[model samples]
Target: MNEQQRTILAIASRVMSYPSESSAEEREHIDEAVDENIESADIRKHLRAALAPLDALSTRDIQEIYVSTFDLKSKTGMYLTAHEFGDSPKRGAAMIKLQKIINEAGFERTEGELTDYIPMLFEFMAVSPEDAHHERLQRRLANVGQRMLNHLEEENPYYPFFTLVMTKVFPNPTDEEVARLERDREEADLEELPYPIMYQ
Candidate 1:
């Protein structure tokens, strides 16, 4: 990827990360990214719209909202494979493959964070040199990313952020792919799986 693409991916990684109590700094960073004009017009618009409400909320409030949205709600999960494979053996296999790719790219997993976390995937994309490995991983992530956007509520603060991030790394899915993703999401939801606990 080019410099501008790398920059935007880095910004998106931060925006999608789990925020601590100090979210004002994160919001400022996002605002600055929006001003940079590195992203396309649609992405810029969505980024601005997503941040507007978040800018007004306190750090605690933002944390609560995030927890309620992603944690309390199963539909908006952060783990890419979880949405597809749930807690089945297939999900474990997928996670292992992702971890292998991350390791091959010289990326280490954070203490308790999973390889499938979207922000970490973005971070990986931002720094890894463009090559066959990156391209293959990007394709895999794009599939999951499309499904993520489909499941997320459009009005949620993180929705536009995800949309902007996914669009940057992945091509928009076709109509048939969209239909398949919808079906996959529904099937995944029906499985009795343990919820993933976020690293504190």
Candidate 2:
């Protein structure tokens, strides 16, 4: 990825993470990154739009919106594997695989956050070297990111941020692939149980 792409991915990762009182500093950095790195006026416009509320709203207000948008709604959760596997053992396996990839790339996991969290993955991709493993992982994340985008309302402030990030990771996904991901996401949502039973 180029400098602009890398800069935006890093910015998106932080902006999409849970909001904190200290986020004003982050917003300043985001503005600077846009001004310095982002060349496209359209993308700059959308990114600034996505972040405008952060500048206006208190941290608690942003936190409440964050919790409602991603935490309360399982379909819109940042944990990407949950969209594909729900609460299944398959989700656990996928997370383990993702953790291994993060370890191999030497990207440290955020405390109290799963490796498959969208922000965690974005942070990893921003700094990690591009390789076969990276490409494969990007494809997997692209699938989940697209589904999350489909779930989100276009008017949601974060929607443009996600669109920008996914655009960089999966620049030109085919129509057939998009259809396939939507179909699979629907099937997974239907077939996977919300709470699995376990026995010893």
Candidate 3:
């Protein structure tokens, strides 16, 4: 998998591993028990390791996560309520408290950008239209995949690799030009390719 994919997996794994809440036995649970935690900083170490190869993706990464995850899916109001809280005064207060805790742990809080919001959109849809969500997301992925393939072709000067793959799958194409090139695959492979796009 790509670096971003690995980072996403690492974060997902960390969240899955962390306990959301814990309860204690009766009596004397108060008075200065556990020290403030560096959980976020610890987790950030893993996240940074996984995402290091994707340094170019820093600015756009969070936005992609938000978009893919937060789709409005439920009528029960839970997800929407949480999403709304971020924009409300109560949430602001909560965020301050949360940030303090994280800061004490030597970790910084970061707001996701526009692309990150897309994941939230997906999550929203999943909660609402259970069956349709899978299909919709599938189509979206395919479209994006195709675009990536096209991008690879456009950015490369060694002849279009995508076109080569495509026309090969359809040998009886109306364009004999494609057939002719297929015969000269070695020649095409010898051409110089350009550098890939730098995300930054």
Candidate 4:
């Protein structure tokens, strides 16, 4: 990792480790990690922007957000795959009957893979002892796992953007055009915003 990536990771570590009931000193530490040293605002910005038109896909899309934001590149022979949930994100319980479908499959999990994020896991334990077993938290770990895998190769802090597909910045020109126009209107502070979104 470069200086800035390291700095941003430090910020991420702080954010991930932030207490729900954080103290003044803890808040100050987080602010210092992000405002004073970290340059990852754009990274967070791009991620929020990317999720806007994604239809808020549950497991995979959310995991994609972290993976892309943190630039987790897969290694050869080490595949990260998920059960295909094309258009919906849902939750049901109370011995819900199986619908001939699994909700989502986890990424490649192995002994070696654990090393990529064990420290982060430890840090997270310090922060959210409750979330240690939450399903959402568990799914997001796939992203963190990918981050650990690629942390060594992430030479440029912003290069992680390549993994994203913001509807506005995505390949389709129409989407890009729409995003650009929306940006212009927002910049102008127009009273009636067409896109109606507050871009990150």
The most accurate candidate by TM-score is: 2
lDDT preference between candidates 1 and 4, better one: 1
Kindly list the per-residue Cα lDDT of model 1 for residues 1-200, writing each as its tens digit: 67566767777677667777656767677677666845567766766775567677677877887777766655576787776665567778878988998898787977788888877887788899889988866776677778667777887877766776677657666777656655654354543245566885
lDDT of 2 by residue, 52-156 (tens): 756677888879878877876776788877777665677788888888888888767989888788887877888899898888777777777787787888767
Model 3 residue 135 CA deviation (Å) reads 37
Residue 140, model 2: Cα distance from true site in angstroms: 1.7
What is the descending TM-score order?
Answer: 2, 1, 4, 3
Cα-based TM-score, every candidate: 0.78, 0.82, 0.21, 0.25
Could you give candidate 4's per-residue lDDT for residues 126-167 as a string of tens digits?
233233253333333334333333443443332242234111
lDDT of 3 by residue, 1-200 (tens): 22233233223322212112221120012111111221344433544343333233333443342222222221111121222243345545544554453355444433552321222322222233224433443343323223223334242221232233222211222345334323422222212233455896
For model 4 the local lDDT of residue 127 reads 36
Best by lDDT: 2
Give the winner by TM-score: 2 or 3.
2
User: In model 2, what is the error at residue 136, expressed in angstroms?
Assistant: 1.4
The alpha-carbon root-mean-square deviation between model 4 and the true structure, to one decimal in Å, is 17.6
Report how far residue 56 has shifted in candidate 1, in Å: 1.9
lDDT of each: 0.71, 0.76, 0.30, 0.33
> Stretches of candidate 1 above 4 Å error?
29-46, 179-200
Given candidate 1, what's the lDDT at residue 50?
58
